[model samples]
Structure formats: structure tokens, C-alpha cells
Target: MAFTGRDKKWLKGPRAVALLAAGAAVVLGLATGGTVTQAAPAKPKPTHMQVQLLALNDFHGNLAPNPATSSSGNVNGTPAGGAEFLATKLEQLRAAAKAQGQETATVAAGDLIGASPLLSAAFHDEPTIEAMNEMGLDATSVGNHEFDEGYKELLRMQKGGCLDDGDGQNNQNSCPDPKSRFKGADFDYLSANVFYENTEKTLLAPYTVKKFKDGQKVAFIGMTLENTPNIVTKSGVEGLAFKDEVDTANALVPKLRKEGIEAIVVLLHEGGLPADPRAFNSCPGISGPITDIAKNLDPAIDTIISGHTHQAYNCSINDPAGKPRLVTSASSFGKIVTEVRLSIDLATKDVDRLNTLANNHIVTRDVPKDRQLTELITKYQKLVAPIESKVIGHITTPTVVRTADDAGESPLGNLIADAQLADTSTVTNGKTPVVAFMNPGGIRSDLVATGGAVTFGSAFTVQPFNNYLVSMDMTGTQIKALLEQQFSGVNQAANKVLQVAGITYTYNPAAAPGSKVVAGSIKIAGQPLVDGTTYRIVTNNFLSDGGDGFPAFTTATDKFFGGLDIDAFASYLSAHDPYTPGPTDRISITS
Candidate 1:
């Protein structure tokens, strides 16, 4: 079953015999002094093919290099990640593979755009799309963030065009280049699990088959996490139903096999975490949704490239038949690239699973930058320069950061919640919101005290979703149900504890999910929350629409849409100059 170059002659026996016969015929014709013609022998079949798969995930439209202190950090103390450097690294990888007669493909697991930084977000992620196209990405899965602007916008991102109804006066020119209308993604975006609710058909292509020069084919099936709708803005996924990831991938396996594509790879938007956070290349004590999904995958699948948790790990998980299958992920923000080498046996037309090798490579900054990518970054940087450097506010202490505690309470989260509460306190309807809740996911980054001053870009980076505040009325019982829901159902795995303002409660982690929160412990403004009484609540529109698995918010009454979350946060910071960290006593965790 193992193939080495020396055994290639056995697989090419028939072709060699045909070539020998042709040579004998030519010799006989020359001996007779008569012109004779014979058909040329067919090209010899390769005994094996080597394919290099270069993958990254959760890029999040970081066209420029992120600061070492931020999301893009040193891998073993080496500064890493910049699109220019990433392009260079990818080219180097492909060149090395080519020298050994191998083919290379650049792919992604998803979140290439949306929730992006100011540079790329300014033009609605057109720049990021262009950057990927330039870098020669072959395909990518659709992450939840890809649905942030709704399916129609996602279609635009794929098909190429400008936003017809641009985002306010500020975004009048949605397309970055006026000389050319936006050209859509050169790479294919796969989404096997997402289907239109009415038609029951896939919204996009389920999978894509890539063929090598020697006719060896590999199919890539892409899908996001099954609970995508729960985390994304409800309106974005209103007409779509996200099916189970494993079921979707399994269903496609037979179809691909029927097409004679024995090599299958899954580009999934869900990922796992390893025991040691620093071990990027080794999988030790790996655990998460991806672990279970990988183990249950059909034996036909050769590899699983994943993302979404934004952690890096290269694991060899066994499939259902107990065959080892490679599963890998690259850290987020273009910080790393996962290079997977798959050996395909031409004889069986399937992957030589035993010979596959995978590892995570850092996109170190020491490499020379790609000049084109550098120019692209410079173009976007100049466009966002005005708003990127404006001084907005100040952080008095470094501890006023986004790092959450055991109960998921963070100084920045508390501050953001308080800002939303204050913004909705005096609405035109005369109904005031007494409590505010911020989803931990919505807090993208920490408010690092750089020289004690925070820029407009820094504030925007912390709250980049462009979410609007929505105030509503919920009963104390519903509020309690929401708190309890955080530790159960779809959320139980991640345990996304909501950040609270003007509310406090203790929860026991050892208790059952439904009974985690201590009864009679919930209080707001020194008063015990009465089960029958109603309280005004304010949260981002995503949460109000029951995002993050908080279904209780869907039943809220008297909903009122307020200002943008970032604006409220900025106004709050402006009012409280030199802000200090708040007490983390809001949500206490009990064992």
C-alpha cells in the first residue's frame, strides 16, 4: 500500500510496453526503407502526486501587518504577519514545492472579511477581496462574519460590484477604485451547510473539485459551524438555514466519490483549542467541537482545515474507521499559514493517508514584503488616515483592558455596557433602559493604554461591528432565563457570559445549566429583581435579535432602536476623561 518512486515502474508497466512496441515498429519500417507511421505512446501515468495545500483562517481583512502586541504576535518571539510578508511567504512555499515537482494551492477556512479593521472596512472589504485575489487564493469557507452584512452583500463580495445603496454619506464611494468597478473574488466561496429556507437548496456551491496536471483530483467541501445563526446577526441569516456541519460534509462525500474524486478535504469555519496555547504545531489535549466532528467524519476525508476559534494546531485525529486524518488550523489575523502535504496514489486515485505531513508556519516579518501588497496597504492606509489618528479619549490604567475573568466580566466590557445603558437612558419615547448587556464577542480588542491616549481607530477597533443599540422591556423572569441560557444549549460549549451594567448576580458552575444562577441573587440598583416586574434593557441589535443563543431577548417588548454602539462608547469616553478600570464585582462565579 505504500508507494515509493522506485515502485513507479510497476504502475507504468502498460505504458512502457506500448512505448517499446512503437519503437520496434519504427525500427522495422527503417529496415524496409519504407515510410511508416505509428501513433505515439500515451504519456506515462504518474504513480503518485504531491500536493501542497497552503491554508490560513480568520484573516479578518488585515491587509497591513498587525502590531506585535495585538492579535498578530511573535511565534516563539519572532514578529509575524503582514499581507505583504504573507504573500512573500506563500510564494516561497509554492516555489519550494514546485522545485520538487509538486503543485501548490492557497486556501482559507474563512472570516477573510467582515469585522475588519478601519482600512479594509472603509471600502466595505473590497480591498481585502482584492488582496486575496492578488495572493491567489483558490477557495475559502464562509464564516459567520461573512454574513455580517447580509447574504446580498456577501453575494456582491463574490460577484463583484459596489454597494448600490451605500452606507450613509460617509460611504458614498463604496468601491475603492473608481477607474474599475469592483471585481469579485477570484477564489470560490463554498458553503455546503447553508441553504435557502424557502427553496431548500444550497445558497452557494457545496464543494469544488481541483484537478492537478496529472489528472489527480481533490474535492474541498466547505461549511461553517452548525450554530452560525446563533452567533451572527439574525437578519443576515433570516432566510437561510444552517445545517449540521458533519451531516453536510458526510452527504457530500458519496457524491464526490461517485465522481471518482477519492481525495477529500474539508475547509471548516469551526476550530479547536490545544492544551498548551503556545504549541502551534502540536496537538496535545485538543478539545472542542472540531475534535468530535473530526472523529466522526467519513473515512473518505483526507484532511480538515479549520478556523473560527482563532487558535493554531496540527492534529492527527482518527476518522470513523480509525484511520488517521490530518486536521489543522492557523491562528487569526494572517499571523500564520498551515502547509499540508498530501501524497495521492495514482494507482488507487486516493490520498496516501500515511504519507500526509502538516505543520503551521509563522508569517514572520523578517521576510521581504511583496511590493504590490505593500502598495495596496498604503492605498487603504491613506484613505483611513483622517479618522485613524484622531485622539478620542484616554485610559488612565493599563488594567482597563479586554481580558475577561472567570465569570467573563472585563473592565472594557463593563465600560461598554455602561455606555449603552447611559445612551438609552433618555429616549424620545420617554422609556429609559436601566440595564445593558454586551456580548463578549462584540468586544473585539482591548483598550490598551498607549501613552494614556486612545485614538478614534483604537475605540473603533474595540467595537467594530457597527451595531446599533436596541432598548427593550423584559420581565425579571425572562432576564433570569437569559442569564441561565448563557451556560446551556448552544452556548454551553463556549460559555459566552454577557457583560452587565447596573445588574449583578452569582452563578455556580458546578450546578446544572438551568439552575446555575442562584435564585434571589439577581439584583439591579440595590433591589432584588422581582419575577413579575418588567425592566428596561439595552443591547446591540444582534443580541436583541436573539443572537449568541440568548432567545429570551426575542420576547422583549417595546423595542426602541438607539444610536450606534461605537458612537455611544466614544461619547462616554469623551465625558469621562482619563478613564480607570471598574470593579469586577458584577458577576461572581461560584464553584
Candidate 2:
């Protein structure tokens, strides 16, 4: 089993390297008569590689601490999310690895930008990009949200385009100009499967080869969900098409193999395992697209870093070849960072030992904030501080936001729907404003009255996406159909709703199928809701695109942009007194 110089050379690639390394270890074992000679057991093969990797995803531009629940649904953590803390952590980890004489790499699985907090989104992800640059990310995959501003905007971020003239339009300096400080991103982007429809070739490099000082080679392929087009706004990715992740990897592996590259990793803009719902500490029970992709990936891929669902976990699964495949994900909003250590056989260059070291650490005041990166964040934070604190309105009562179990609507959801409805009606020439509905998933956080001061920033923290308020007139029959979408059933069980502004309905899960709505509870302003009558409604553009399967909104007539929903919500709160709903009657799906 001993490997000759020629054997080691042949096993240089990542795939065959592991086998060769194993073969050499076997030979060494036999030669030593199953026992190692003196000399401290020859220092044994390293259980981990000298390379340390830190990965994160789904930050959602939460430049401030976000209120997140524990996986186990108990206890509250400290104020833990911000660019300063994230940078601090990344630097600390990198410094530790460097002290150990190992190379460190920081990367993201995407969602590094869009649908961000008021500070980042308002600037069209420039601030987020600046933050990521300071954080030292090496590369990332293009997540669905990256398409929020359309392909041109994506190109702008990638190629360093700007609005140097201080105008928002793409008038001048759209791509690259000689005078601007826009040097583009310090890292690269991978898009193995995404392609231009008109051209079959990949729109971005399928993979990037990273070489370490030890002559070890690692190739990374980045991919987003294959259904990105369906999930994001259509115009955002007009000329692009996404291909299957596994297929793309399979096709690219041979090329890497031919080039003598062995170690391969996937930076997938997908996700896995929820953090312990019972405890906020660690992740458990792997799930989602990443699991499926890992299970089906070619054996050549050694590890997968995933995001999107915003949960954190460290585990390994079996690939199609029956070899162990490692996968890890960090929780969303900079709440956690995953460190994956891979050990490869030096002689054969194949992965032998791989393990996940940590997850779900609070990025709090405890960590030593990196002064350099903190300065960068501080500059932008100061620039947006005034706008973020500008008061929008106030709520007398606490507004709760809950999407646990993906069940019924939350009070915050109701606020968002009302905002959309109010805004839409106010803008349209003669549109009726009967009622509005917001999906619970759209409401990101709860707002406490806390002395009755609410700001524009706080409102954005509730509904941050740039989704325009949309209005439509739907028949009562359509409303009933929308209710059915949230009904649990054998085939369609994942259903939940958010509260509405003016519309009210009751759901009785105990009732027979198709009869869950209470007989007389469906109403609008004390009127018996006629099944055939049309009523004006408001919702976000995401729901209008049939997100979360609320297809009824898509069928409604008279759709138009009603401006920012948060503004309307602010106006509604200003006009109303105290703003308290009757009860938690938004949804009660009984057992």
C-alpha cells in the first residue's frame, strides 16, 4: 500500500488524492506492524487542514442588533448583530488561524445585500457592499435577492458602477469611470449554473480555484436556488436562467479533475437545519434544498456552505457515491458564523478528516471590535443615523410579530397589510379601499410601544423590502379561495397567514375540509360579505407575484404601485387613536 513518488503525483488531484493518502496510510500501518515507532507516533496526520474558513449568509442588512428567538423558543440573547461585531469576529478568527500558521478565508453564501435594513437598502446595497469588503469576504454566490434591483444593478455592484454625479438615475458612470473611488468588490462571485438565456455559456465563472501556500488546491462553485426566477421579481433577472445545482456541479467536476484540482466546495445560496427551536444555541435536524443537493452531489464536492433559510447547523451527509459530505450554515442577520475545518492527506492531497467546529455565537459588545473595519462602518452609520431615527408615527399598544410554526397572522402582519392598503388607496385616482391583507412572513419583527415613539427606521425594520403597495378588487369568492390556501391538509400542510387592516375572517381547523371558515365571521365593515361582490384590497408586490401561494391576490383586478407601504402605515397610525385591535382574532385554527 506504500505510495511511490509517482503514486503521490498521480493522486495530486482532490478526488484521487484522498484515496492515495489512504493507501499511503495503509502502507505505513503495515510497515510499522500495526504499531507506530517512537518519535511521538510520527505526529499523526492532521485531523484538520491548515485552512480555516468562516462563512455567513442572509444578513438582510441588519446593521443593528436584531431581536431573534432561540431555536428552543426560550430566553433572549444580547444585542448581537452589526457590521462592527461581524468584522471583529472575522478578524479574531483570522488572527487566531494566522497565529497558528494556517490560512483563513471568509466567505458568504449570498443575500449579502438586498432587502436590507433602511441604511443599506436606501443606498441600494452600497453600504452593505462596503461592509462586506471591510469584513474580508473572499467570494459569494448570487442569491435570489441579489436580483432585487435587476441585472444592471447586479452588474453595477460586480463591476463597480456608480451614481457619481449624486443623481439616482443611471445617467453617467454606470459601469466604470476613471475618477470614482468605486473599485468594485474585493472578492469574486461564482455562478456555476446561472446562464444567459440567449447564450448557453455560464454568465459567471462556474468555479474558482484557490491555491494555498502548501500547494493544496480548493475549487469553489457558487449556485443559487434553481427556482430563483420564480421567487424574485421577473424583471430582476430578465435574460438569465438558472440550472440545477447538481447538474452544474457534475459537469464542472470533470473540468476541475482534468485541471488536477481535487478539493471542491459549494457556496450554495440555500439553507439547512433550523437552529434548536427550544434553545437559541445550536442547530438541529438538517432540512431544505441544501440537504437534497448534498445528497445528490457528485463525490468530488467535499463541502457545502449554505444560506437563505437563515438557520445554523454543522453536519455531514452521504453523497451519491456514498462518501461523507460536510455541510454547514450560519444563522441569518450575522447572528452566527460557521467554521469548517477540512483535513487532507498531505501525500495524496485528498480530504481525510473534516469537521464543523462552531456555530451560533453572539456578536455582542464582548468581542473586540476591529478598529479599522469599525471605522468604515462608523462612517456609513453616521451618514444614515439621522434618517434612520426620523420619527414616522407611534403605536399606543405593543405590536407582536410571530411567524413560529408558520401558522396564523401576527399583529405586525396586520399593520403591514393595512399600510399597503392605505397607501394604495390614497395614491390611486378612484380605487376603493375596502380592506387589506399582509402575509405574516413579510413582517420581520415585533414593535414594542416603549413610550410611544416609532421612527421610519423602526417601520423599515418591520417591513424592509422595497416592495410597492399594490391594490386590487376581488370578489368575495376570491377571498374565500385565499382562505383555503392557508388551510392545512395532507398534501398542503405548510400554511400560515398575517393579519389584515380592515378585513376580518375566522378559521376553524376543527371543521370539515373546505368548510374551515366560520359561517358568519367573514365580513368587511359590518356588512355580510357577499360571495359575488368585489372589494378593494391591498398587498405587497411579493404576494402579488404569488409568493407563499396566496394566489388569490394575483387574480384580483386593478393592480398598481401605491408607493412605500411603511409610509402609509405611518399615516394610518398618525390618524388613528391608540391603534389597538380588538383581539388576537386574526387566526384561530383549532386542532
Best by lDDT: 1
Error of 2 at 587 (Å): 12
Which stretches of model 2 miss by more than 4 angstroms?
A: 1-49, 67-79, 164-180, 274-284, 353-364, 385-415, 422-435, 439-498, 501-518, 523-591
Task: List, residue by residue over 330-404, the lDDT tens digit for candidate 2.
Answer: 767787777655555666666553322223344665676767666765665665665566655667666545443
TM-score of each: 0.70, 0.68
TM-score of 1: 0.70
- Native RMSD of candidate 2 (Å): 10.3
CA lDDT, every model vs. true structure: 0.79, 0.64
- Candidate 1 lDDT by residue in tens digits, 1-591: 222343222222111100012112111111111222233421222577889899999888888776776445566567888799999999998997887788988889989987676778767788999999999999999998898778888988889987754432343247645577888999999999999996769888888999997789999998877787655556677889899999889988888888989999999999887776566765556788888998898888988999998788766666788666778899888888998777789888898765566657789998889999999898877766655666778888863677888888998899999899888422635678889999998898888657988877788888876666888889999999999999998988879899999999999998998999998899998799999999988899879878889999999987765556887887888888978887899999778
- State the local distance difference test value for candidate 1: 0.79
Clashing pairs in 1: none
